[model samples]
Target chain A: MDRSVLSIIKCFGTELYNALKDAQDDISEIRIRKEKSVVVYKQNIPYAVTKQGLTALELDNAKNEYITVSEALIKDAFAQLCSYSVYRFQNDINNGFITVNGGHRIGICGTYVGENGIMRSVRDITSLNIRIAREYKGCSRKLADIAGCEGGILICGVPSTGKTTMLRDISRLFSTEKMLKVSVVDERGELSAYSHTSNGFDLGLCDIYCGYPKQKAVICAVRTMSPDFIVCDELTGEDIESVCFTVNYGVKMIASVHCDSLENGLKNVSLFRLLKTGAFNKVVFLNRSIIGKIDAVYNIGDIQKLYE
Target chain B: MNNMKIIGAVLIILTSWLTGIMLSKRLSQREELLIELKQLLSEIKRRITYEMPTMCDLISNCGTQYLKPFTDNMYNSLSGGYTINESVISAVADTPLLCVLQDCEKQLITDVLSSLGAADSTSVREITDSAIIQLDHYIGLAQENRQKNSKVYFVTSLYIGFAAVILMI
Candidate 1:
C-alpha cells in the first residue's frame, strides 16, 4: 500500500481505516464532518461506510455502520498533517485547505475570520473533505487523434468529469514519447503527477511550475521553459488575459474549464472574444455520462462542429 | 604519626564542608539556567513568528550551549518519528532535573513546549509568557534559598564533623 493511504488512515480509528482500505481503489473522496456519518465517494456515488465495508448511502439513520468524526480526531489529524506545527500552515488553513505530501487536498470547512475584506484565519474547524489523488494513465489518448494539431485546446466538463486526469495523461504522452518541450502550470500541484510513485510519474522531460497562480506560472513557463506546449488545469476569468498572452507567444496550450455544456462555457464574454480571435482551434466537451468520452468537438472562429 | 592523623582529620572536615557548598552551587546554577531558557523561548517565539524557519532549524538555533540538550532531544525525537509536541513533552517530563523541580514547574515547561510551535502569533505569545512567568517564580525561589540557606548547610556540616571528632576523642 502507498504510504499516503496509510497517512490518511491515521485520521480514522482502526475499524473505519480497515473499511477504507478495502474500498480504497474506488474512493475519490472521504468526507468527515462533525457528528455526521462519514461519506465516501466512488466517482459521484456516495456511500456511508458500514462496519463490514462500504454500504449503500444510508445517511439519515445513525446506525452502527456509520462513523462520526470527533473533534479530537480532527485535532490529531491536523497536527500530524502540519507536522505538529499549526503556525506553519496558518495561511494555508486560512485559505480553507492544505495539500498534503501526496498531493491529496484536504479541504477545511470552518468559521472564517477576516477583517477589511481580507481573510485573517479560520477557527473551530468542524469538517474536512479529503480528495484522493489518482492518475489514470493514457486517459487523454482519444483527444490526441483530433486535437493533436490544434494550437490551443480547452477541455470542458463539469466536476468529476475526468478533465484534469485527461490533461495529466496528455502531458505525459507528449513529453515522454514525443519528447516535446512541455511546461505544466500546476497551480495547486495537482496536475504535475508529483503525488504519484515512481511507477506513476512519467512526466518525461516536462517542466512543472507548481503552486504558482495560473496567470503568473503560464507566463513564467513560456519565458523560461520555452516549451512547445503548456498544460494548466482549470481555467477561470482571471486566466483569460494570460491565456491570450500565451497565444500571442505562439505556445500551444491545453487547459481545462468547468462547464457542462459548450454553450455555457462560451457564454463567458472574454472567453468568446478570445475564441473568436482564433486563439484556440478546438474545444473538446467531455460527457460525464460516458466517462471520458468526448461529447463534441467545436472548431473555434467558425463555431462549427468539427466532429462529435 | 600524630601530625599525619591531624592532617587526615582536617581533610575529612573539608570534604563535608565542600559537599554542603555544592548543593548551594547547584541551586544557583539551576536558577541561571532557567533564566537563560526563558530568553531562549523568547528567541524561538520571535523566529517562529517572523522568520518562520522549519522546526528543525528553529530547534537548532533557539538555544545557547546550555540549552543544547533540550533542543537536541527534540530534534532527535523528530527523526525518531515522534510528533513535535510528543517529543518536547517527553524531554521536559523526563527532565534530568525532575527530582529537583516542583511539580508545577515541570508541567509548565512541558505545556509550553508542546504548544509553542503549533499556535498563531497571539496564542504563541500567551504560551511563552505563561512559561516565562512560571520560570521567573522558580528563579526567585531558587535565589531566595541560595541566600537564606547557603550558610545553614555550611555551618551544619562543620558542626556535625566537629561533634563526630569530639565524640571519638
Candidate 2:
C-alpha cells in the first residue's frame, strides 16, 4: 500500500478500513461527516462502500448501503492526523488542514475556537476530507519548457487541480536532473510531503523549511540554503511579499495559486502586483479534469497587460 | 554429616545476601527513574524551545528502559487516533517500570505526561519547565532516600532472612 493510503487505513476503524483496503486502487478520498454515511471519493466522484466490500454509486443509495461514520471514529482519525497531540497541530488545525506523511492533505471541519479574531484550535470536529496526494513525474516538464525553463513559474488551479502534485514533481525534477539547489518552503508540509514521523515525498537535493510561513521561509531559504530556485505551494496572504523579496535577491521560484482562468489569475490584485514586480515569469494554469494538462500559459507580457 | 550442615549454613547465608541485593534494587530503581524523568523533561524543554519536534521523535529518541514501554504504547496508540493523554495514561499504567514506583511518583509522572503533547506551545513549555523543576526535588528526595533506604533494605533483608534461618535452627 502507498504510505498515504496506509495512514488513512490506520485512522479508519477496522470494518471501514478493511472495506477500503479491498479496493484501495479505486480510492482517492475518504470523507467522513459526523453521523452521516462515509463517502469515499473515487474516480472524481463520491461512492459509499458497504460492509460486504460492495461499492455503491452514491452515498444516498440506501441507509444500510454506506458505512456509518461514528463520532469516535472521526475524533480518533483527527487525533491520529494530529499525531495524538492537538498542541502540535494547533496552528494547522486553525488553518483547517493537516498535511500527513506522504503529502496527503486532510481538510478539517470543526467548531472554530479562538481568541479575538484568531483561530486557536478546532473543537467538536464534524467532518474530515482526506485528500490523497499523487505524484506524476515529468508531468510539468512540458509546461516548464513552455513557460521558460530558467526563471519563475507559477501553477494555478482550483483545489484538487494537481497544483501541489505538480510542484512536488517539478522540485524533484530540477533538483535531481538539472542539479539545481532547490529549497521548498513547505509551510503545510504538502510540497515536500514531509510527515513528522516519516518523509512523504522525496524531493532529491532540496532543502525544505517545513512549518515556516511563506514570508519567513522565502527569506530563510534564500539566505541560509542558498538555493538556485525555491518551490512552494499556494500563494496566500503575505506570500507575494515573500516572493518579491526572493526576486530582489536574484533567486528563482516555482509556486502555485488557487485559480482556474488566465484572466482571473492575473487580475488577482496581489498576484497582479507580484507579476508587475517581476516575481514570476509565467503562470501555468491546469485543468483538474486533465491532471497536468496546461489549459493556458500566461507570460509576463500577458500578465503585465492585465494591469494595462 | 558435618559437611551437610556446613553446606546448609552456606546456602542460608547466600540466600540472605541474594535477598539483600533484591531488596536494595527497588530503592536504586526508584532513584534512577526520578533521574531519568528529570532528564527526559529537560530534553523535552530543550526541543520545544529550539525546534518543534513531533512527540514520536521526542519519545523515540529519548525513550529508554522502563520508559520504552510508555513510548512504544504511546507511539502505537497515537497512530490509532487515540488522544495523547489517553495513550500516555494507558502507557504509564501498563509499563512495568512504573509499577514499581510509589503512588505519589506515579501521579507526578501522570500529571507531567498529561500535558506533554496535547497542549499549546506556551502551555507545553510551561508544563515541561515546571516538571523539570518539580522533578529536581523528586530526584533529590529519591537520591537521598536511595542512599538511606537502599542500605536499610539490604541490611534489613539480610538480617531478616538470616534470622529466620537462625530461629529455625
Candidate 3:
C-alpha cells in the first residue's frame, strides 16, 4: 500500500475511534470516504456504497428507519453473512441491540432497566450501530519487537484506547505469519466479528468462542480449544485469578485490561494479583491522542524492574 | 306527680335508644371481622392450591441426593469456594418448606454436634447457628402464609353461618 493511502487509513481509524469513544448513545451510521469509494456502515454492517454524499441518520430517525428494515431482511442479511443472531431488532423504541456470529459487535440504545447494579437487559432500543471488523495488514509491526517470540502479554488501557483494535491486529499477525493456533474468547463481538462464514477481518487459523461470559469462556477455551495462544479483552474481577491459575497449565495468554495509566494498572487489585503470580511475561501500555494517535508502548517487566 | 312521670318516660326512651345504637355498632364490627377472616382463608386456599406443590418439591429436593450432588458439583466447578456456601444458603433460604424442615435439620445437626469430639463441637455449633437463622426466616414466612389463609377461612365460614341463620328465620 502507498504511504499516502496508509496515512489516510490511519486518519480514518483515528477519527472513527474518537467518534465511538465520545458517543453518548448508539452511533446509527459510520461513513468512510476512501479515495476510490464511499462505504456506509449501518448497525456495524456495511449497507450501501456510493460515490456521492449520503445523509447519516440521526439517533431517533435512524431507529425509526431500522424498525422498517424488516426482520426478514435482517435475517437474510445475517444468513447470507453466515452470522447467528444473538438478539433481534424488535421495536425502534425497545429491544434493539443484536449480536451476530463471529464476535461482531453492534451497539443498541434505548430506555434501560437496571436492578441491583446489574443491567438485566436493554429496552426501547431505538438505534443500532453495527460496527464492521477489519484487520489492518501490518498493524502489529510496531509492537513486534516487544512481543519477542511470544510468551504471555497483557495490554492495558482505558476505554477506546485502541486496545481491542491492537489485539485484533496482533491476533491476525500471529495467525497469518506465525501460523499459530489462536483461540479468541470474545465476550462481546468486537475482536473477530466473523458472521455467516464472512469475517470482518481475515483471521487466519483462529477458532473463536463468542458470547460466553469472560472468565467462564476463558476456562472453557483453555480446557477444550487447546490453543497455542489465548487472546481476550477487558479482564475483570476473579478473571485475573483465573488467568493466574491458567498460566500454571502452560498456556500463553494475551489479554487487554482497562486502566488510565501504568500506575493505575499496577494499583488495580486484580491486575496486581495477576502480576504477583508471575503469569504475565509482558505488559504493553497504550497511549492515544484525542484523534487516536499511537503515543507510546511500555514494557511491563521494565516497569516492574523500576518499581523493584 | 306529673314531673316524676315525665322524668320516668324520658329515662325509658334514653335506655332503649342507647341499646339499639350499641347493638348496631357491635353487629357492624362483627361483620367487618368476618369479611377480613374470609379474605385471609381464600388467600390461604389459593396458596395451598398453587404454591404448596413447589414448596413440597423444594423441601424434598433439599434432602435428596440429586440436589446435594448438583450443589456440590456446581461448587467444585466454580473457581471460588464461597460459591458453594452461597448456593447452599440460597437453596435453603428460597424454599417455602424450609421453615418446617429447618428445625428437623437443626435437631439432627445438634445430635451430631453432641456426639462429635469437643474440638469439633465449636465448628458444628457455628454451622448449626447459620442453619437456624435460615430456618427462622422460613418459619416467619410460613406463619405469614398461615395467617393469611386462616383469616380467609374464618370469614367465609362466618358469612355462610350468618346466611343460614337468616334463611332459617
Candidate 4:
C-alpha cells in the first residue's frame, strides 16, 4: 500500500489507522458515519473494522465490538481534509466531495447552509465515504492498438468497473509509446491528483490540467496545448457543445461515461448527443468481475444505426 | 578618603541611571511588540479576505521576520500532523516573541489563531477584525503607559540613586 493513502485515513486518529494499516492494500473504500460502525470495503466486500482488525461479522451483530466512528473523529478528519482552511475548499465542499492527495475522493454528507433558498456550503458533517483510488499500470495494453487509430474512443461502465484506470493507462501509452501529444483535463484531480506536495500518478508525457471544468479544459487544450488527443473523465450534458467543438477542431477525445450496456448508454441524453457528434468511432464497455477487461466493443456507426 | 568617596558616589549614580534606562527601555519594547502584533493581524486579515489560503501557506508567505518564532512553530506543528487548533495553541505557547504580551493580549492572539481557519471567509474575517480592534486597543494602552511611565521611571530611579549617594557622602 502507498504510505500516502494510509496517511489520509490517519485523520480519523490512531486507533482506526492501526487497524486498517495492515489491510490497506485490499481496501477500496472506507465509510464513516457518526455513532456507526466504521465499515471498510476490501475488494468489493464490506468488513467491519474493529480495534483488533477487520472483522467478517455483520455490522449489526458486531456493533458492540466494532470501532464506532465519533463526531470528534469526523470533525477532526474534516478539518484535516480541508488542510485546516475551510475557506480554501468552499467550492469542493459545496460540490459534496474533496479530492485529497493520492487521488482519494472523500464524499462528504452534511447539512447545507445557504441564503434565499440557494444551496451554498456544507456544515455539521455526518458521514464521509472515502473512495480509494488505485492505479493499474499497463491496464490499457489491450486497447493500445485501438487507441492508436485516427478517431476517439468512449469508455463505458458501471461504477468501479475500471473506466478511470483504462483512461489513465491509455493516456500514458499514447503519450509515451506512440509519441503523440496528449492533454488530460483532470476536473476533479482524481486522474492526475497532482499537488504541490505530490507528483501524483505518472501519466507518461501527458500534459495535465488539474481542476479545470471539462468543457473549458477541452477548449483550452485545443487552443493552447494543440494536443493530438484530449483525454478527460466523466462527460455530461453540458459538455456536448464543447465535445463537438473539439472534434470539429480535429482533436481526438478519450473520455468515460457511466453505463451498463450499449442500449442503456444510448439512453443517456448527454452520451447520445456525444455520439451524434461523430467524435468517437468506438465505444468500449468494461466488465465488473474483471477490473480492466473489456466486455464489449461496438463501432459508432452501428450504435447510431441501433439508436435510429 | 575624599577621592574614594567621590568615586563611590559617581558609581552609584551611574549604576542607578543605567537601571532606570533599562526599565524605560522595557516599556518601549512592550509598546513596539504590541504595534508589530497589530500589524501582523491586519496583514493576516487582508490575506484571509483576498486569498483564503491555508494557514501554513498564509504564515509561510507572510515574509516577516519579527514573528519568525511563532510562524516557525506553527509550520512545524501543522506539518507534524497536529490539528490546526492544537498547532496554533502550542505554537503560541512555545514562541518567546509572544512573551511580552499580557494575559488579555495573549488570549486575544490565541483566539485569532484558533479561529482563523475554523470557519468560512466571512466568519474568519469577522474574527480577525475583532481581534485587530482589540489589538489596537492594547496598542493604544501600551503606548500610553510607555509615554506616561517611562520618564517617571527614569526620574524616580535617578533621584533615588542621587539621594543614596548624598547620604553616603
Candidate 5:
C-alpha cells in the first residue's frame, strides 16, 4: 500500500473516531478493501464507509428509521481523510454544519437548536454528504461577456440550480480572460474551490480572502486588495445593505443566490431590497432542465415588466 | 644605614607597587564587563524588536491568510448567504489593525528583554517582574480593544435592525 494513501486512511479513521465517539462506543474494526476504500463497521453492522468502498445500502429491520449511510458523515470522514484540510464546525450549531478547507462541502442535517429565532446548532445529525467541488476550465464561456461588462450581475436560481457553478465560471472569466483584478469573497469556499492555501480551481490572476465572513471579506477586498471586481457565492443576510453602501468604491460585484423563477428572483424580498439599492444592474436567472441542460437566462427587469 | 630604616623603606615600596597593580586590574576588568554588557544588550534588543516582529508578522500573515478562507466559509454557512458585503468590509476593517498590533507586541517584548539583559542578577529579577507587568498591560489593552470592537458590532447591528428585516424578507 502506498504510504500516502495509508496515511490518508489513518487520518480519516481518526476524524471518524472523534465525530462518532460520542455516539458509538468503539470503532471495532476498520477494513480497507482494494487499497482504495475503507469500511468502518461497529459489531459488523456497517455503520459508515468511504465512497470508494460504498455499495448498496443495507436495511436494518430492527432500526425503525432507514439505515442508509448519510452524506454529512461521509463528508466529515473525507475531510479527515485529507491531510492538508482543516475542518471547522460553525459555532452556529442550529443550521451549521462543517466546512472543510474552502472546497469540499458536507451539509449538516438534524434537529434545529434555535434560540430566540436564531439557529444555534444542529442536534441529532444523522448524516452528512461530502461533495468535492472542482473548477472546470472554460465553464464560463457563455457567460463571459455578460459578466465582464462594466456593471454587476446577479445570478438567480432555485436550490441546487447550479447558481454557484455559474458564479464560479464568471469569476474565472473576469480574473483569467478579462485580466481584471478580481477578489473572491468565498464565504463557503464553494465559488473558488480554494483548498490547502492553493486554489482547487484556477481563479486566473485573482486574490481570494478566504474564511472571513463574506461581508467582511468583500469590504476588505475592496479596500486593500484593490480589486476591480468582487465575486461571491450565496448572497444573503443584512450584509447586502453594506454592499450597496460600498458600491461607491468603484469595485463591481458578481454574486449568486437561490430563487425559483425570474419573477421569483426579482420578487424575493432580499433580492428586491438589494435591487432597490441600485447595487446591481443585471439579474440573470439560470434554469436547469430534467436532463441536466442549462436552459435559459432571463432578465429580472423583464420579469418585473411582465408582472406589472 | 640602620636595619630598621632599611626594612621600613622596602615595605613602603612594596605596598605602593601592590596598590598600583590592583587598581589597574580593577579598571581593565570593569571596562571589559561594560563592553560585553553593551554588546549583549544591543544584540538582545535587536532580536527582540526587529527579528521578533518580523517573525510575528510572517506568522500573523500566514495564519490570517490561511485561515481567512476557512473562516469565511464558516461565516457564509452561518449567515445563510447574506454575508457577502459584510465579509469584505470586516476583512478590510480587521486585518491591518491586527498586523499592526502584532508588530507592537513583538516590539514590546523585545524592549523588556533588552532591559533585562543589562541588569545584574538582582536587577534581572526586578526587570523580569517589570516585563511581566508590561506584558499584562498590553494584553489588557488588546482585550479592551477587542471588547470595544465587539460592542461596536453589537450596536451597529441594533441600528441596522430595519435592514436586517429587509434582508430576511
Candidate 6:
C-alpha cells in the first residue's frame, strides 16, 4: 500500500478505515459523499464498503448492505484533512480541492461562499473524491528510448489513461538512468507531493518545483536549475506562450495533453500550436488497455502533412 | 531564658514576613502571566498579518517558557484529532501555570484559542486584537490588586506576629 494512502485512510472513521486499509494497495480512488455509501474504485471497478470487506455493488441491487457515510464522518474527515486548521487550507478550499501530504488529491464539492463573484471558500461540503497516487517504478521502461532520444514528445491520453504515472516514471528514468538534470514543474504538487509531513516519490536526480505555476516554474527552472529537460503535466492553451518561449532556450520539453484519439490530437489547437513551435517532433498516444503502453508514435511533420 | 524568648519572637516575625511575601507574589505572578499572554496575542496577530502560520505551527513552535507546556498540551490534543474547543479545554486543565489565571481570564484565553485556525486571516487578526485588549484589562486589575494589598499583607502579618509574641512573653 502507498504510505500516503494509508495515512489518508487513518483519517476516516475506524470502521471505514479498517474496511479500506486491507485493500488499499489495489484501490485507486475513494469516493465519499455525504449520507451515501462509500465507494472504492479498484482497477476502475466500483465496490461498496462494508464491515466484512469490499462488496461489488450492483446498480440494480438496492438491498446490498454497505456503510453509509454520515455528516459527522464527512465533517471529521474534512477537519483531519485540514489538520484541524481550516485557515491553512482556505486557499485550497476556495479552489475546490486540497492535496494531502502524499500527493493524493481530494476533490471537494460544497456550497460556495463568494465575494464580488470570486470564490472565498467552500462550506457545507457534499462530496469528496480522494484520488490515490501510485508509483509504477518501471512503467515507462518501454518508452525509455523515446523518452531519452527526444527533441520533444507530446504524450496524449484520456483521463485515467495513466499519463501522470507515465510522466513520473519517464522523469525518474531521465534523471537517474540517462544521467540528465531533469526538472519537474509540479503545478498541482501531484508530481512531487512534497509536503512538511511527507517527501513524495523519488524522482531520482530530478529537481522538483512543487506548487509552482507551470509557465513560471519553467522560466525559473531554465534560469536557475538549467535542467537538460523540463517535464510538466496537462498543458492547456494558456501554457502555449510560455512553453514556446522556454523551448527557445535549448532545453528539451516533455508534456502531456488530453486527447482521446490521434485525429483529435492533431485537431487540438493547443497541440497544433505546440508542435508548430518545433519543440515536439513526435506525439505518443497512450492506451487505456495497458497503462503506459504507447499505442502509436507519430512524427509531427508526417502527421501535419497527412492532415493537411 | 531571655535569649530563648528573643529567638522565638524573631522567628515569628520572620515567618509572618515570609508568608506576606508569598501571598503578594501570587498577585504579581498573575500580573506577569497576563503580560505574557498579551505579548503572545500581539505576536500571534503580527504573524497572522504577515507569515500566516498554521495553528499547529503557531502553538507548537511558541518558545515562551510559561506557555510552552500549555501550548504543547493543545498541540498534542489537536494532533490527536480533538476539536479546537476540546483541545483548548484540555490544555487548560493539563497546565498548572495556567491555573494562576482567574476563571474569567482563562475563559477569555480559551475563546481566543478556540477561534484561531477556524477562520480567515482577517477574522483571526480581529480575534487576537480583541483578546489582547481583554488581556490588558486583566493585567491592569491584577497590577492594581498587587500594588494595593502587598504592603498591607506585610504590615498586618507583622503586627499580628508582634501581638502574639507580646502575649506569649
Which scores higher on DockQ, 1 or 2?
2
Candidate 5, DockQ to 2 decimals? 0.02
* lDDT winner: 4
- lDDT of model 3 at position A134: 41
Per residue, candidate 1 scores C-alpha lDDT tens digits across B24-92 of 677776777777777877787788878665566678677444477677777778657677778877777
* Highest TM-score model number: 4
For A113-198, candidate 5 gives per-residue lDDT tens digits of 56688654454555443333445566557666554467777776665555666677777777776788888887766666565445
| TM-score of each model, in listed order | 0.79, 0.83, 0.44, 0.92, 0.48, 0.90
Model 5 lDDT at residue A218: 74
* Deviation of model 5 at A167, angstroms: 1.8
DockQ of every predicted complex: 0.43, 0.49, 0.01, 0.67, 0.02, 0.54
DockQ-based ranking: 4, 6, 2, 1, 5, 3
lDDT (10s digit) by residue, model 2, range A3-91 = 56765766768877777666756466778789887887766776776887746566356556677778887887776666655667778
Error of 1 at B91 (Å): 1.8
By DockQ, the better pick of 3 and 5 is: 5
Please give the distance, in angstroms, between residue B142's alpha carbon in candidate 3 and its true position after superposition: 47
| Per-candidate clashes, comma-separated | 0, 1, 25, 0, 43, 0
Supply the TM-score for candidate 5.
Answer: 0.48
Residue pairs in clash, model 1: none
User: What's the lDDT for residue A96 in model 5?
Assistant: 49
Arranged by lDDT with the best first, the candidates are: 4, 6, 2, 1, 5, 3
- Tell me, by DockQ, which candidate is best: 4
lDDT agreement with native, every candidate: 0.75, 0.77, 0.50, 0.84, 0.51, 0.82
DockQ of 1: 0.43
lDDT of 2 at B130: 81
RMSD of each: 4.7, 3.8, 20.7, 2.4, 22.0, 2.8
